[model samples]
Target: MILKRLQSIGMVFLFLFGLLLFPIRSHADSAAYVIDETGVFTSDQLLELNDLAEQVTNDRECGVYVVITKNMHGYSERDFAEGLFFNYDLGYGLKDNPSGIILAIDYNDRFYDVYSYGAAGDTFTTARLDSLNDLVYDYLVKDDWFGACKAFINKCDELLESTGYVYHTIQYTDPTIAPHIVETSPEQRRNEFLLRLPFAALGSSIVGGISVMVMRGRNKRTGLAKNADQYIVNNGVRLTQSRDMFINRTRSVTRIQRDTGGGGHGGGGHSYHSSGGTHSSGGRHF
Candidate 1:
């Protein structure tokens, strides 16, 4: 039996050695967020973006992914992006809702899409995705691939923060909950503040000037009788007893035209290109 024991130990040793020689890529690894199949990003960039995505995913409880591929692999832009998300099983937690958002880039095809699934879909509504699509497209048009991915992560974080976890939690748990509405972003708010800033400044300046004048007027210590008679100079005192008459009033009406055309944002929604999966994407062709 000594020979049999030696054979078994030899097999065990080989198995252990093989594991060391070939390490498997697990989901727990650090670079799970940014998957670059095209070799577009350097090691340092991948790590940095991966960390950012991971932190956002954890804080938001929804995955944020940036997936770059050479081409769509013989599939349409929408099909390929959704397919990758599913086939890769990319998401957070093993729950029913494998909620995640993907910014898929097809470098060869000159096309890109921001796909959102499960709870992420509910949170990243069409309007928000459109905004992100526009933001990323600006970078991609300039061949700023790294900038696009970086901006994608940062914007996702910003959007998620504004809505809190309402979309991620409420929708998944109770379908009856009122949907989360991402009405405004920090950028939009800042723009509004800027628009009103000039008016605000003007009002403040006027108030300040008036206050100063009032203070100066109060400090003059007026001696009424000294100069009042000389200061009041009337240029020809002539009075005619005439009454002013009222004239007829005329009114002009201008018709206000209405625009029947819908907004650009109406083109997006929760679409199910195929069963077993659903996503929201306003694909951009740059």
Candidate 2:
């Protein structure tokens, strides 16, 4: 009886130990946003991008997916992209009205597509999606997978910000936020202001002193005209009956072109497949 009890206790301890050694898999592993089957990105690069993509998806409550496949699997780039999003259940939000965006690329065919669903479709405008593709193309052409992925992530972050989505975990400094002026911490700004205060004061003093001296010299050189008529020319000023005349009023109208989101001259647009999935896609031969 003693031996049997000891055995049971040891079995319970072993069971608890097994739980720690073999932890349950996270949803990230199952619903990975970055699927680089072509091995374009290194393991480290893939891990980094996956973390970024997952965070953006969660924050936006919308998906931002990327798939780098070896082939199109018998479907066009656009169709394949939409099918992948649908099949893999890649979106978030309501089941009937899921929201997400996907970027599918086939390195073998040099084809790529960017598509949005539900809320993401509304957030990522057609023009912005095409513009994003244009931005990523520069790196794709150079075979810089990591660079392209980074660009895509950064662009998505910016678009989300436009829709009032703020990312706090990682701070990415955008120079365009405040052009020419570099951002500084409070202490740095105060130190800089203090350092420049003396020079600013000196410059102001010099300018003020020069103006005062000039005004004093002018005062010394001239006396206020004792009489207004004394300084006036006899017929220097003449006023004729010149009524305010309006010669043909001219009006110029500028036609502010609206962005149709058909991608610019060489840009692309979104299309729908038979399944009713919308796709905003663009690509070129590398």
Candidate 3:
């Protein structure tokens, strides 16, 4: 009985030691900058965005990281964003206080937050971050994950470049648009043409049918008289009086309304302070 009791105690101690030694690991450092835990990005798109993030960080000397997960582990949007930025150890700035920005998106919760640290917070004002959200909100609503992420990166890069931190960096060209016209690839144009072909063919067929019906009606009416004029002897009747009659005429004018005031201005900018680091604004929810 004593031996059995000792063995049981020993097994309990061993189990407790195992539990202490093999605690669940946090996913904090599992990714570098962009983490798509929900598989929101395709292979090619993920590669492109990761490359973009790396390039931007190297060029600007500040981290522009993105984290896309299914949930935020019960933290609020802002807290999750700030926590991730710190836990991930993102930023290339000074050792004392790192500088960077992180865009955290929780797919399951349909929540997104943009958190900035150090110099990034100073550069990315509240209004500017809101504008960035504006660029991506519609795309996100439409489930265009890649488009939304690309927009976020593009806008961030542009804003960073504007601050003179990163100068003369080549911009990301949106394949969806050029100067005034939407850019269309050859395959896209072909697909469009193919999609409209049936409609065009139907329209042509309808017009052809109408023409044929009109021709048949005309054939049936050939040489037929609707009045007694055709039956009258050639040049048998003569008119003595000829006069012109005036009809009423009218015209219409459209009044054009002009905008009387210039564009309205916006309100004051705001920023959030987190753990002594000032972050930008905007938390989007679906």
- Measured by TM-score, the strongest candidate is 1
Candidate 3, residues 46-92: lDDT per residue as tens digits? 87998888888877777888888777755666577776666555666
Kindly list the per-residue Cα lDDT of model 2 for residues 1-286, writing each as its tens digit. 9999999988996786554334222322533788776778877888899899989888777778888777775665546676666655577665554677777778888777777665565557677788878877888888887888778877887797687742222111221111212233232344455566557757977998999999889877746656677667989779877698778978999999998866422223443222333556455555
Pick by TM-score: 1 or 3, better one: 1
Q: RMSD in Å for candidate 2, one decimal?
A: 26.7
Model 1 C-alpha RMSD vs. true structure (Å) is 26.8
Q: Pick the winner on TM-score between candidates 1 and 2.
A: 1
Candidate 2 residues lying further than 4 Å off, grouped into runs, are 1-31, 165-277
For residue 254, what is the lDDT in candidate 3? 94
lDDT of 1 at 165: 45
**Model 3, TM vs. native:** 0.51
The top-ranked prediction according to lDDT is: 1
| TM-score of every candidate relative to the true structure | 0.54, 0.51, 0.51
Error of 3 at 283 (Å): 0.7
Q: How many residue pairs clash in each candidate?
A: 0, 0, 0
lDDT of 1 by residue, 1-286 (tens): 9999999988996786555334322323537788887788998999999999999898888889988877775556566666566655577755555678888888888889887776676567777888889999999999998899999999998888887743332123332222222233232344455566557757977998999999999989867565555665586445667788989989999999899774432223443322323444458789
